[model samples]
Target chain A: MFSLLQQAASTAAETDTHAAPANAEAAAAAAAGQGADAAHAVEAAGAAAHAGEAAQSAGMPQLDVSTFGNQIFWLLVTLAVLYWVLSKVALPRIGAIISDRQGAITGDLMQAEEFKKKAKDAEAAYGKALADARTEAGKIIAAQKAEIQTELNTAIDKADAEISARAGESEKRIAAIRDSATADARSVAREVTAELVRAFGGKADEAAIDAAVDARLKGAA
Target chain B: MATEADTGLAFHPMEQFVVKPLFGDGPIYWYTPTNATLWMGLTLLAIIALLVFGTRGRAIIPSRVQSIAEMLYGMVHKMVEDVTGKDGLKYFPFVMTLFCFILFANYLGLLPKSFSTTSQIAVTGVLALMVFVGVTVLGFVKNGTHFLGLFWVNSAPLALRPVLAVIELISYFVRPVSHSIRLAGNVMAGHAVIKVFAAFAAIAWIAPLAVLGIVGVYALEVMVCIIQAYVFTILTCVYLKDALHPSH
Candidate 1:
């Protein structure tokens, strides 16, 4: 099997060498004539060579170009392929990435602006809340002070009424004491004069005597 | 118009200028034309004109000139992307600008009596050296001594590492030489071929040779101009990729 494979490889190599010579000859001939027929003849010769080789090589005939020319040709082809791939696939992706980064920067700026606005609003809200707290506290303190003052005023008025009623009752008690004392004192003196007149048998001018005696007793006391 | 023979092209290498001043003492700097400076100046003017025209008014959608500029931008952008994967995009502008400058210089040289800036070895060498030094500096700056990993082949077995490293080192050092030679050789050879064919046009019997030579050389030169530009840009992309990713 290996020998057969080796023979086949040698034969393939031979056919490739033959095919290249034929193509080169045709290329030289085509290059020689500037006319239209020469162009067709070159193509026809290449086609005929390919056809003849195709029948012998199990449907896989090697190409008929020098390795250097082939390399140069393929270099161009690969370069074009590379250019296409870069232009179509890779470049757009990179451009998108750059655009995305740019968008991110702009978005960050806008977000910062938004956050600044929010912060300002929060500051205003806090200020209003603090102001409202101060006003509410002031109102509460004022209300508390008014309630305390009213209670104090009510207590003072009740204390003054109690003191006034006690003073009036004391005065009435003193007036009663004075009037009773004077009436008792006058009756006691009259009784004392009658007893003296009854005892001494000289009961004349009791009122004058009583008056003189009362005057003399009052002067002595 | 001086022909090749009259232009002293037959002089030995570096004999185009010789000082012999006993007969009439003089300075040649004043009389000798500065081809290098003159061509560079012309290229700069061309670049300025292009930039001025292309960017006269910025548009989201491109005008003709703008589109042409964008097409160039797109070409370099894609080239960088492919050769360097995604990372090479950062150097797109630099690489693209270089490609555009060299390409325009080459294309302009194809015109009658126009100088090819890249045809000169010094110019090509300087540009290649810039790329080489830039890439090397970037590798060192970004990766430090670890950039040597590019040549170390850490993936290789320890036994084979020395050999691989040596080979890679040689190849790495040869990059600038290859790059400069490839561009300079292509441009110089294409121009030389064209010049030879143009000279052949003066002969009657050699008219056919001239025609064939002109057509083939012209066709080939056009391809060479574009390929050299692509190769230069792609190499830049590859070098930048190495700078960015030192392991490979």
Candidate 2:
């Protein structure tokens, strides 16, 4: 198509150049007389040719049967190159990066989960330890309370036995003093009755005096 | 429009889409590189810059380009998995290539004077046909005879089953056509509309309005470019899902 257009353009140019010198005077006079009209016709022709080319190439080049093979060939080449680059080079690298990031994230999460479990276990152990200490403290307190109660009971029993022994000894000593005083009083009453019988002409009754003194002393005690 | 161009007040919008030979005005042979090839090469370079060179760092903490590369990778990967399930992820590379190629082509077309490779039906058609062929082959390979069950509507009444089956079969075949046309049509229309508005910007009275129209259309084209790429990739995933799991 391009060759044909070039041929037509060259032929037209050749005719214009060939005819110009030969009929220069006549053509010049004619051109001056109808210059605008001639120019209009030439412009119209050029525009028509341009419009024809444009129209030929215009609406859809895909509909053109002649260029299909070339277009298809180039398309295949480009697509093949693209597929090679994407599949072999770009895609695999990108996929690797994404999966690597995912793996890192998953690893971190697993570690965190392990830490959480450890923390939970530690908390449970601490709670168990605290409960054991409390129970042990309670047992210690109960044992000490029982021991204090037994010691208090033993001290009370010893104090009560000492007070009873002291009371018994004091009672025996008071009885002995009372008996000695009563014997001394009986001797004094017999002596006083004998002295009275010597001084006067009456005989003293020592035995009777002694008996009375003894009876009086018994009543007083 | 012809008179407008004749008066030198307008431009040929479709001229941009022409597949001219890059070096000379020679006839384009099958191997002759053209403007389409140049832009496609550029798109490939862009992909290489993003995917291969950008990810050369391989950093655990990605650099800017690496970040973008990774984001694209993750986006397409997740999209495939979500749309087609884990079993369908085996085809992630193919789907990713389709997405990146179309996406870069569409975006590169937005550059001044750059040709949109995806805007051509030849390109989009090939891509869609590849997906179709790949998915269909995968279906048969995985499920063997059961792949045919995709066309059968068992839930339908006995009388309506065959009718539903025919409809399903036609729609299934039509997927490639619609898929190719949707991308090419959208990209071409957007670029052509922008060109039209740009040409109208030469007019003094409506120059501001024309500029506004171009801006609006360009913005919409940006969105359309990305969305069309996404649509193509997702559809590929859906088809792969059908291939992997050939149930209703």
Candidate 3:
């Protein structure tokens, strides 16, 4: 491989010398060809260099003791910057925003709870007021009912007293009539007995006639 | 073309990861800006654009960019809180920085001719180590000597407790190794596979197949890019939880 590469390099050098002074047209074509070759050579050289680099970077550059210092230094610097940015600037701002939003939510919830409690209290008060009004109305109705009942009782008592008074007057009149009738009947009986006695052939005795009429009257009573 | 063909093309897939000085080739000093530095700087810029410019509005009703910024913020915040509980939230900014840097680095690497910063174990190692050290220190500070109980499985049989403790101690030390490699390995492997597929494009007959392969691998890489970032951050949260509450 080494001999072949040497041979190719020598040949290329000879071609370059010969091609420099050839006819313009031929030199142009040769130059073009050389350019292509040169481009290819550059590419090959780059590939070879990359392969060398690969060999050097093989295993791990991390394990390479020589570069550790550089790597660590840069890492420290970068980490320090990143940490500062995060802790000092970015995080605090974000944390504040989050906490602020949470605070707002909690405040709004508390306010809503207060409103709900107020509404509940109002409802309870309204219920109590309604119950009180119902009781007052109930009492008024009962009181009116009692007043009407008492007035009815009083009117009934007055009517009973008047009726009793009228009844007593009628009873007294009836007693008086009965007494007069009795007396009239007694006189009529006596007169009748006398007339009967006179009509008879024998003279009738007044005492005997009076005694018979009294006895008859006593039997009738 | 024929001459060029005589000189066979040597495709190097790993060449993309070379960290050289950005300016004229010179010895890379510690302060020298390199391809790694360039890409890392770009990652930082991308983060700034998203977190700062994107959320500059701070509107009650967010715009598209603002919404994305807020979503990323909420995602990391919730992850920290859920994994580490509320105590873990204090370190949210640190975790967020690591996530954003890795996430952006992985994504930016997908661009044509872009370098993947997270593909380097050095970067990931440092990140993982920071978490390891921080968590360890926090464990001691918070729990005093009782933090050692984390490795001691008290629930195990008394005879087996010591055995389990050794295993736990070994695994505890291995946390940074696995954590760092998981991110770097995933990123590097995906990128390397894509590079290999890309290199095949040089051949005439297989060029179309190579393009197709690249497309498929690229799609997978996109998912991997975000997932690796999430994995790294979540692992950090898990480790942190152990430190904060190191009883069992």
Candidate 4:
């Protein structure tokens, strides 16, 4: 297993080294090419100088400028300018944009976390408030129920007392009326008995009958 | 020792190092350095100087210069934020260094006959290696043994485990190749096209073809410069994101 792993590692190393020669060749080509361009420009300038002299003989003052070196120089200068542009200006701006974005994102994440915490707190408070309200409502309901029960009991007791007092008064009045009617009834019965006794005086039993009649009349009156 | 070609091309050097000959390439090359190394060294120095000057006092209320400095910081800061989220902020210095280095190197190469460090595969490979090793190490350090779990992804069913693992491993290993190749290819191809066009102007009297190529490549190179820098930083962010949150 170790050997197999080593083989794999060696293969990877092999691929890495394989790229070296090609890179060196390309670098050589690039460096050599630039040198060749510069030499060509010098040759062209020398040719132009010869041509200008030839033209001057024909009544024209021709100028010969080495576009070759100028181009190379300017190209270099342009590259420098580009480097400065990116390093000093463009990159900095890009960097700023990136940082601002990061700040915004981080700020947003922190803000979201804060909001979530607040929401949780709010939910907890709401739950507590709800529970407290329910408890208070329960207490109020229980107290009211107890109070109503007590009130009903008191009202029932008052009604029972009133009914009993009315019943007592009614009974007393009935007893008094019955007593008066009984007296009236007894007087009528006694008068009828006395009348009847007077009508049959000669035919009635003597001393016993007189005593019974007197006792009954006194009791009836 | 000057060749006819050497007379045409100018001198510019950056940094120097040893190059051991592989197989039959003769003796090893030691620090008989060239212009390429010098420029690379100078590029590094320039970057350091700018950053140092820019961050000297670090005022909350920025001056004109401070604004430019802050802008650079902000750009990298934003890139990290977008790609890596809040955790990216911790890697601000590193990411910024990378962005500035890449941007400066690219721009510097555009100077007349200047060496492009990124044009070389060794340089690109080194950069890619730095990112790869750095990110991988960071992943392991952050997640410990859990980082290995990033390879397996056994979250899938038993039936698919082998296939997914293989695919993930291939992609993971491919990161450095693609990263290095992309930067080096762009730089190389861009310079090559410009060189070819410049050569055409030297050879023949055709104005349109050479001029168009020169102008067009100039514009294209400008875009590539920014794009490559962005690509580098963004990838860094993505790698960092993976490091911080390895589940993905």
Cα misplacement distance, residue A145 of candidate 3 (Å): 2.2
Q: Cα deviation of B56 in candidate 3 (Å)? A: 3.8
Q: Model 4, range B76-142, lDDT digits (tens) per residue?
A: 7777888888876777656776677678888887877677766655566666777889889999999
Instruction: Fill in the DockQ of model 1.
Output: 0.00
Q: Residue B240, candidate 4: how far off, in angstroms?
A: 1.9
Comparing 3 and 4 on lDDT, the stronger one = 3
lDDT of each residue in B48-132, candidate 2, tens digit only: 8998888777777779988898889889999999999998788888888899999999999999989999888788888999999
> What is candidate 3's CA lDDT for residue B117?
87
lDDT (10s digit) by residue, model 2, range A3-86: 323322333332233232322222232233333433333333322223334322222334434456667777777788778878
Tell me the spans in candidate 4 whose CA falls farther than 4 Å from its real position: A1-221, B1-30, B54-63, B154-157
Q: Kindly report the interface RMSD of candidate 3, rounded to 1 decimal.
A: 9.1
Candidate 3: regions farther than 4 A off? A1-66, A155-221, B1-10, B57-64, B157-165, B201-209
Q: Which is the leading candidate under TM-score?
A: 2
Model 2 chain A worst lDDT run, 10 consecutive residues? A18-27
Reference-based TM-score of each model: 0.48, 0.78, 0.69, 0.48
Candidate 1, B91-150: lDDT as tens digits? 665675567667776787777666565765545666687789989999999899999999
Residue-level error in angstroms, candidate 3, position B243: 2.5
